[model samples]
Target: MEPHLPTTIQISAPQHAANNPYRVIEGEEVLSVAFREFVLTAVAAGWKEPEVALTLADIADDYVMALARRAAAN
Candidate 1:
């Protein structure tokens, strides 16, 4: 199998820190770029079909959201 290349998602820090404390501290850390990387890696590793890639991407999206929520709660 070929190597899986990682992908990055750049999430900039949101403004209005007083309104969103999590955004002020965690910032882009709340967004799971690693999850996006995992999905891309899976796609590069023989999972070339569109449906499979989309499924992985969805999973990655869920992961990112979950991470953000967790970060916010803390």
Candidate 2:
């Protein structure tokens, strides 16, 4: 595969982000950039696409389950 720069995803709701005290707008942007860099680095270092996808899904699943557990507790 030809080498290309990883793209950063732009946050669409900067105003809403600013209104939310729990999440900083700049922090989200930085995390996105960092995530892209990590993915690019992983691919460059011989990680397969499936592995990367599975990792992402696992992370998302963990987050979702944590939320679910919190809701149940509440």
Candidate 3:
């Protein structure tokens, strides 16, 4: 019998801030997928820039929900 294998994932942020002043803050999320796919999605979705500049609390709920959905799928 074969045992189930766990999925290994990692997320990271930029080491420093972006140079763009329009970006109140800059960071990144690293997913374990094909580099091309990741870059394409980020570029197409325009998630590379901050959509809104607000406190972390403002987006915490939505972020948590997103994390939950991703976790559930895995």
TM-score of each prediction: 0.37, 0.50, 0.25
lDDT of 2 at 57: 79
With a 3 Å backbone cut-off (N, CA, C), the pairs that clash in candidate 1 are none
Give the lDDT of residue 28 in candidate 1.
54
Estimate, for each residue in 1-74, the C-alpha lDDT of model 1 and write its tens digit. Answer: 55545556556555656577676556555455645565566666766667676887798799999999999999
Winner on TM-score (1 vs 3) = 1
Ranking by lDDT: 2, 1, 3
| lDDT per residue as tens, model 3, 1-74 | 34434433344555554776534333322332433354444445544424322333367678999999999999
> lDDT of each prediction vs. the true structure?
0.67, 0.74, 0.49
* Ranked candidates (TM-score, high to low): 2, 1, 3
- Backbone clash pairs for candidate 3 read none
Residue 39, model 1: lDDT of 54
Query: Per-residue lDDT for 45 in model 1?
Result: 73
Candidate 1 residues lying further than 4 Å off, grouped into runs, are 1-48
How does model 2 fare in lDDT?
Answer: 0.74
How far off is model 2, as Cα RMSD? Answer: 7.4
State which candidate has the highest TM-score: 2
Please give the lDDT score at residue 20 for candidate 2.
Answer: 77
Model 1, TM vs. native: 0.37
Ten-residue stretch with the least lDDT total in model 1? 27-36
